[model samples]
Target: MYVLEILWIVLFRFAPLPRIWAVCLIAINLGALFFLDTTYGLVALLAALTGIAVMMVIYSRLGFVRLLGIGHVFWIPMLIWFAASLPDRQTDPALYWWVVVLIGFNTVSLVIDAADVVRYLRGERAPHYRWRAT
Candidate 1:
């Protein structure tokens, strides 16, 4: 999971292939959710929808900068939930390692996202591609 997440992040950050990376990540996440227990999957889906709605409202009112500021707040509870759901380390070593990898991925994402928010708050414009100099 860590490797996969890192690959996705790298693709998004430096590969200049945002749409492909986004689609691949979305597909992978959906596949994972599909394999989860029905109740948990449904709850996660709902939470995702709620987060999108909240982000949309924030973007509409405060614009992209503020939205990025608080957009990743959901990760805190998600990390906790993932930790709490982890299987016993001794009895299920593979599952334990997988959960740890997921935690690491989320931690990295949280740090990066927070740094982006801080940069925005400090008046740095978000980076983007340019076809030619203005």
Candidate 2:
């Protein structure tokens, strides 16, 4: 699909920094899934999957930096739930650390997305990259 091609180019070609960041984020999400049945792991994985679904929809209609907030908006409340239920959630050291990293990493990403959305609303509407069929 053109959206996939465009997303690939947007992340890999036009934006090397974002590419590296995306890889790291993917690693974190996948790493967190190692304990899928424990300590909020299922919810975390769901959030990641849901975020991906939302991101794909947003990407279909807008550029990466523009409406990126919509892709990440669900994460904040999930983080809050993670924090509120931390002590009660059954977690070992590994799962605990994964949750911590997931919270920290996604919080930073949400902040970045918020800023990007603002920039977009301020007229930075041009897409960073576009893919054309060869």
Best by TM-score: 2
Clashing pairs in 2: none
lDDT of 2 by residue, 25-118 (tens): 7788788568777757777777877877887776677745477566778888889998776633353777777778888888888888899889
Q: Write the per-residue lDDT of candidate 1 for residues 20-77, one digit (tens) a residue.
A: 6445434533443653654334544554555556655655455434334365466578
Off by over 4 Å in 2: 1-7, 87-91, 132-134
Candidate 2, run of 10 with poorest lDDT: 83-92
**lDDT for every model?**
0.53, 0.73
In angstroms, give how far residue 104 of model 2 lies from its true place. Answer: 0.9
Assess every candidate by TM-score. 0.55, 0.80
Clashing pairs in 1: none
User: How displaced is residue 98 in candidate 1, in Å?
Assistant: 6.7
Candidate 2 TM-score over all chains jointly: 0.80
Tell me, by lDDT, which candidate is best.
Answer: 2
